[model samples]
Target: MEMKTIYFAGGCFWCMVKPFDSFDGIESVKSGYMGGHIENPTYEQVKTGTTDHLEVVEIIYDDAVFSFDKLLEIFFAQIDPTDAGGQYMDRGTQYRTAVFYTDETQKMKTVNYIESIQDRFDKPIVTEIRPAEVFYLAEDEHQDFYKRNPERYKQEQIDRENYIKTQKNLS
Candidate 1:
């Protein structure tokens, strides 16, 4: 089956990567930086707020198994679109929320989705929906972080915090 691509920046590419990877239809998720003026900005350079980039995750998924709309739904649930600053625990211009669409189809779909949810929030959605730019993959160490260090990564999971604490008798 053919696959489609969607790129999103909701903050901490670490947190963003796992959610998409868990989706049954998703083929893969890549941590990257986008919407920036500089080319191939390092994690440090971007974090310093020198570059305009936002930490983004590029998702490759089978369109047959999951629709673009479905992906957008999941993305919306993961971050506060109205918060133009940054997501949950992350802060900085590089961690700001954004939606990078590859084509016109994805662009229109994103617009519709944002419009549908507009009234649900008091503030306007600050998510920037634009054409996909060159995506610079993060360092190898950042890839599959959750799988490599179960204990540490599991602790990072917002939902798994209580579960892990209880198991470790630290609750």
Candidate 2:
């Protein structure tokens, strides 16, 4: 089986894991920091929005079973792509939505997918499409946070779902 890796910065890294975890081809979903200037930034540093790092998830999967396009679809559904500032209740550059593409094919597919869905929203999609950068693994406390802290994670999911519903109604 050929495995491929993709990185996605979609709001709080904690909220990004569970959505992709249950998929058949998915190998692992790890919380990490990317697109940052600092080396080995901690969650505290990135959360401050000063390290220039965005909270991201490093996703590894079997490309033969799970396609990149499917991953894009899942990513887009999780956050408001039009929100340039941040997502849900999290407000910061670190919470912004982005697709960190690792290859030409991933780049092209993401660009096209964004374009095709442009008409669906009144606002322009602001999700960033960029080359994959070094991914610094987040603290152990952050990995699988939803599993570790179910109540907190559930509350976050509720808030995010409500916001998404409201946005859909507006558009």
Candidate 3:
């Protein structure tokens, strides 16, 4: 099985990583920063929204285990694509929704994915689908934040998971 990496920014990396990590195809989801102008930006820099970077989660997956299209589908389900500013409970450019494609094929795939859902939203989808830029690993405390802060993270995860599952099941 070939492993591939894709970067995404959908909101708080802590909350965003949970859904993908539970999916069948995903191997791992790592919290980090990417698509920013500052080199090796510190957490402080990103928090201030001065850097070009967005808070992102780097996903590792096996192609055979999960198709890129499937990954994109699950990604869209996690956030309101119509919200251009940021996701729920998270506001700022740093929390903007985005899909960071790594290559031409991935880019085309993302375009198609967005097109497929163009009508579901009243406003145009604001999720930026672009080629991925440099990814900087976040501070140690940020990694596996869900594990470290289980009480809070677990509740959020449960809420998100239930919502997505119900959405899919209803459809």
Candidate 4:
């Protein structure tokens, strides 16, 4: 039961949790702040985009059951990897999409996965692949947000799906 962790910034940490959580072998998905210059940054601080922090999720998964590559596939599918600003209705530097790799293996996997899917989309992927930095767990209220607020989470999923459908039409 070897466990590994990855950090992802895919706009609205709340929205990022559900897709990964739905899969088996995902031990936990914690909403948090990563890549920030300051310590203990609040949501509002990161939201202002001055903290250089991105709203992110720290995902703990069992690698033996689900390979990191599979996770990357799921992650990429759930996000607008080509969107540099944000995902769906969200916008701002703090909402940018990124994969914070914990090691060289993860880095290689992320880069390779991104390249493999290039032909599937019309635009180039702009999602950042960077070294993992300090990850500060968000407030308890933010953790497992989808589980806590199922209706709101469902609506977000609907909105994202509709947005993606609209985006596909334009391309």
What TM-score, computed on C-alpha atoms, does each candidate reach? 0.87, 0.94, 0.87, 0.92
Backbone clash total for model 4 is 0
Q: What does candidate 3's lDDT look like per residue over 1-171, in tens digits?
A: 778899989887887777778877688889899988879988889988778688999999988888888888888988888877777656788989999988787789999989989998878998998888888999998888887999989887777677657755986
**Residue pairs with backbone overlap in model 1:** none
lDDT values of the candidates? 0.83, 0.93, 0.85, 0.89
Q: How close is candidate 4 to the true structure, as a TM-score?
A: 0.92
Residue-by-residue lDDT tens digits, candidate 1, 44-120: 88888778988899999888998999999989988879777676556678878889998898999999999999999
Error of 1 at 140 (Å): 0.7
lDDT of 2 by residue, 1-171 (tens): 979899999999999999999999999999999998989998888999998899999999999999998999999988889998999879999998999988899999999999999999988999999999999999999999999999999998898788878867996
lDDT of 3 at 26: 80
Off by over 4 Å in 3: 155-171
Quick one: best lDDT, which candidate? 2
